[model samples]
Target: MLLMTSIIITISTIILLKNKKSDLLDLKSEIKSISWPDKKEVNQSMLTVTLIIISASLIIWLIDSTLTFLISKII
Candidate 1:
């Protein structure tokens, strides 16, 4: 999974950089507007990440536990 994810990210980044190379490089002033996420938005994103991590961990633990229990019973 990690290898697959890395390959996908690398490919996408390369594609993006290739596309952006055609644009004129300007270092004097900011051309694009940067909007930072508000506190509420940041908090929401953090909450989402935390929830996903916790859920995935729980699922993995449950699966391992079930397999171990089943194996012990069979033995």
Candidate 2:
């Protein structure tokens, strides 16, 4: 069983190495073609995300507090 597993692994490895070389080259070219964000754009995006997250958290907290107060009053 061990020998069969080793042989299967070896064959698969050889096949993958041969076939994936071209795919890797294509990926490298595609990455080079991409328009990466500049530092200013990245900072602006991060700030926007942080503001949205804080706003959502505050809204959720307000709702939770309101429900808790109403529940406490009813009890």
Candidate 3:
């Protein structure tokens, strides 16, 4: 599409104008210094996030249903 081509050209031109060799090299070095977590730690953290999401969804569903039921009885 024309829109996609224009966007790609704009982004590429901006990057070419702004990004320099030393800046890119510094960014790469900083990225290389990061200490990423192991597989076990990643799995444990993912499980905690999943459980929290499910718990919050169930709580919202319960509250919505209770409000709907109460409103229907009042009408």
TM-score of each: 0.56, 0.74, 0.70
- What tens-digit string does per-residue lDDT give for candidate 3 at 1-75? 999999999999888867776688989999999999999999999999999999999999999999999999999
Tens digit per residue, CA lDDT, model 2, 2-64: 999999999999999988998999999999999999999999999999999999999999999
Cα error, candidate 1, residue 24 (Å): 9.8
In what order do the candidates fall by TM-score, top score first?
A: 2, 3, 1
Model 1 over residues 17-65: C-alpha lDDT tens digits? 9767655454223455556899999999999999999999999999999
RMSD of each: 15.4, 3.7, 9.1
Pairs in steric clash, model 2 = none
Worst 10 residues of 2 by lDDT: 18-27
By lDDT: ranked, best first: 2, 3, 1
RMSD of 1: 15.4
Backbone clash total, candidate 1:
0
Candidate 3: segments with Cα more than 4 A from true spot = 1-19
